[model samples]
Target chain A: MTAQPQIELTNIDKHYGSFHALRDINLTIENGQFVALVGPSGCGKSTLLRSLAGLESISGGTMKIAGDVMNGVPPRKRDVAMVFQSYALYPHMSVLDNLTYSLRLKRRPKSEAEAAANEVAATTGLQKLLRRLPRELSGGQRQRVAMGRAIIRHPKAFLFDEPLSNLDAALRVHMRKEIRALHDRLRATSVYVTHDQIEAMTMADHVVVMREGVIEQQGAPLELYDRPANMFVAGFIGSPAMNFVDGTVDGSGTGARLALPDEPSIQIGKRLEPGRKITVGLRPEFLQLASGDEAALHLSVTTVESTGSTTYISSLGEPEIVVVVNGRTDVAAGDKIGLAIAPENVHAFDPETGKAI
Target chain B: MNRVISSFRDGKGFDIALVGAALLFLGIFAGLPLVYNVVMSFQAVDMFSLGTFARPFVGFDNYIAVFSEPIFWPVMRNTVVFVVASIGGQFVIGFGLALFFTLKFPGSTYLRGLFLVSWVMPGLVVGAIWNWILAGDFGVLNFALTGLGIIEDNIFWRSDTAFSLWAVIIANIWLGTSFNMILLSVGLASIPRDLYEAAALDGANGWQRFWTITLPMMRATIGAVISLGLIFTLQQFDLFAAITSGGPANSSNVAQYWAWDFSFRQYDFAKGATISVLMIALVMVASVIYVRSTRHEVRG
Candidate 1:
């Protein structure tokens, strides 16, 4: 949104002995942006977040925070705050003391520290529970205390490492919005790390999908959803992952024929070499049940699952196809069905590179 | 009968039986001797009454006489100094070693395990070894001290009245430091590593993290370690016997060694029991503190 970047990382690399944990990572985040680094476990999302916090030093890179080069700066000198997945609240200290620890460490006056703690506590809805120790609070309350401790510091950037992973499902959903709201209210630069793509899609203004320490794709939430750069991003970004079916370009060069038993042909929006091998990507929600004349592919139904509002139909064949239909459908197992999709909703990828075409 | 059998087979009766065995053993071996020592402190006992429980009631006469003895105040002062100094040295050095080991350089686990050697060695054997190291003329400590320019002379550690009690305290501290380090290492290890990360990100340097995070989290452990140190130091008699033998003119004499001397050598069983009764009272207070501390762990 602005010309000045708040955080910039260029040519970042990390190594633990012979293992390269992170490769040439280049990213720049603008001021007050809520960015989420999301991937599966062992993908180095959390490691990247920790590197930004200065908890783990980069093996080779130039890291800048607030326009200052911070390559060798220690975490305490970095002027950033982190909320751990374990909450990591001071277990022995009361809620008020936990919130005021940073202030007290600076040798601030007791009255000034308490006033700051009280203000943060009120903002976090922890006013009535200030005297209770961390062990006395429930999981959600401890989470709030962890956040309050971070908020009291007025840090330059807030780094969150899977902060909602410990909560129950309902509470995780609730805290997701709460954390995003807190980020908006403070307008603080935040870098959130989580393995759940839904949390990334729902909460972050910009989402960076990662795999094995490499950024596969990064853009606005809908931009990534509508146009993924690769198969990994296409499968990772959507709820019901995109389905890939092997296909070959038709003689017309603008249509493709699927490899199913019927060899049904569908229109593609681009021109390619005739008889070129490609992979067709179809989203579940975009596929529709078609009548005989407009049917592109015909398949037998394998199973039908419903959750009151949507019906999930799995087709019976090799390279299984799943279709999500809104409202209830009477589709049952062993029933034959026809499927169709518009040309624009369909995506194609090169079978070798797995990159979107 | 069926109900009783069933309780033992599938209920609380078996648990009670297991606990009852431990209580019975304690009653016979430990509790009886403690109660007998308290009782003997209140009665007049001689060689004729040594075999029997019955003795003439003295009504605090033994306590008053023992308190009035010429060596009593000096022995009490020596005991206090011995306990305080030994515990202080052990804790400070042990805590330093514990924090050092947490750096986890290569082979740290093996090196830390090696520190347990001093803790497992018999006290008398350790004291015997210290006796050689603490010899008047050819001692390693005196050599190091003089080499460091801390002292000029050999100092005659065992014979000099000023350093006689300190001689035993030095050995006792060496004997106890390893145990202190081991317990403290466990306490330090149990702390989550993320807490330090959180604190560092919250703008606490290493020193502030220790004072705020490490020290408060170690409350239960510190309480337990200090109280146990008190108990062990109060019961420390082997170092005195092996190193100084209460020295020339009773200079290094303490309560436990003095109690042994009165009971076995002087045959003044009443005075011995009186001194022991005082020690038992102190140890009881320490026991209460140890239990309370270990029970109330400040963990989330």
Candidate 2:
């Protein structure tokens, strides 16, 4: 038999007066799974995470942790710990006291609380800094203290609200690795929220892409990257974003050809009705620069940006196209380049609805 | 270095002129009077000799006499009592009101505005209003008490020394509380909301949060309010002048009124200047100690 979910949110809705902040969000996290909610600003990812931790009250719906309803339960009683973006370490408290504050409040024995705090501190490499106040610690050290506070709780679930966003780029990468290692060691169910796609791709077991208070798509990181459900997900999940060319279909059922606005017609694997305007989406990585004698669509190159590993080429058209070529090619501005796009890599969506067809 | 010196020389005259103007104002307004009072406090003079800069110097005889007088110690004691009671009551009640207004409550804004009305009223007006309310004969308080059958007859509020002090305290509490409330309310609002949230998540209950987080966060504001309140309460005069008028044989006489009695009522300017100089010294010492203690608290 399968283990029950450690936390479950059912049909949750949150409203700030007349403004709807979170829609009907239904989610479940099984034991030991790491779920990352990835979205743009104001997408309600942090709000949803706060609600699950009982930091925020939901306007409607039921939240359960370990099979018990959590409505009206304060954050302290929720048996979950959160690491905030700002760390929120008590400025007046020593690192040791900050880690043990919750345990003392729970009426645990003083020795037990101290031992647990020390253990977590040692694990986070903060044992030597236990007596130092938060203001004296570096930003990374403060972040570690925040994480230590969460770990000492032995909570049913862990919530992270952009915990790494405040750190410098190098520290953020280092901390992400540490967090992943900690999760593996603890095997604690965790829900993290972040807007950085790299973070979402690197750390998440399951990525839930949200937009405008609604979940656009949720799947394993690569699955969501490969098969985005709609235009928003297609654009949001990847760096450099998927390029779309507005076009119309020519033939029905089994023989659909996509007519580009400024280039040659292309054949699609799926059938489409004639005269239906559709958007053809292509990831930049799939568009290959072709030679002059090759049978490929011709375009004028607008700009080229070359990194060591890949070169990005922008083409001139009504809806401009960008292509990411592996290994630096000899492409520059005003260069005429031919491009070939694989049919399997193409995504067709209804232009008006922005939905995958 | 030479060029900088030349530039400094060019602007030195204007700077000196500004400094001279400021010094002249201070001499006329603050420094000269303080010097005159100090000199006068050491001299023996009556109202006729007050305008003369030259008077018979009595050394410390005036100070010795004032200290030896029978009414001097009692008036000082009364001033201390009135200041401590009034300022202490104002701090506690004003902080409570500020905290109450800080909460997300219905009609709190309107209530705050209404509370401020007493503070905005002139001190003399407040004293008159309270005097009418606390009067022994034809007073609203006595009438209400008699009508409720709680008392047998009129209570002489101003006649009893202890009751007069308490009555003055009540009026001052009403007038001064709003000042602290406004200042402390601003302080409370300036505290970041996330600190409270952090405290809550750290398992601190309301009282724990208040003592550990709220109080310490508002320490500067509390110190400022208390210090200013003490100073204002110590020098209070108009209320007493309007209401009790140091009535019933000097029973309600505070230091300010006692000094006024010597200077204005008896036309003894020398003794009054002596009392005024002593009051200034006492207030200065209190303020200095307060500043030092707060500085220590902040550093620690």
**Alpha carbon lDDT of each predicted model:** 0.92, 0.84
- Per-model DockQ against the true two-chain complex: 0.87, 0.33
* Per-residue alpha-carbon lDDT of candidate 1 for residues B143-239, written as tens digits (9 for 90 to 100): 9999999999898888899989888989998999998999999999999999999899888889888998899889899999999999999988888
lDDT by residue (tens digit), candidate 1, A109-227 = 99999999999999899999999999889889999999999999998888899999999999999999899899889998889999999999999999999888898989998999999
Candidate 1 stretches greater than 4 Å from native: none
lDDT (tens digit, per residue) of candidate 2 on A1-357: 139999888999999999898999988888899999999999999999988877789999999999999988887677888898988776667899889988877779999999999899889999899999887889899999999998998889889999999899999999999999999999999999999988988998999999889988889999988888889989988878898877777655423344443546665557777778888888888888776655356778899998889888988676678899888988789987887776777888888889898
lDDT of 2 by residue, B1-300 (tens): 876667557877668777999999999998988988889899999867777888999999889988988988888888888899999889899999999998869999898889889877988999999999889897898899999999997888887875787778878988999999998898788776766776676667888779877887678778878888878897788899887887666777888888898988988888888999988898787788668646743211
Alpha carbon lDDT at B218, candidate 2: 77
RMSD of 1: 1.2
| Window of ten residues with lowest summed lDDT in model 1 chain A | A313-322
Best by TM-score: 1
| Poorly placed runs, candidate 2 (over 4 Å) | A107-115, A127-133, A249-262, A267-277, A292-295, B1-28, B35-40, B52-59, B141-154, B289-300
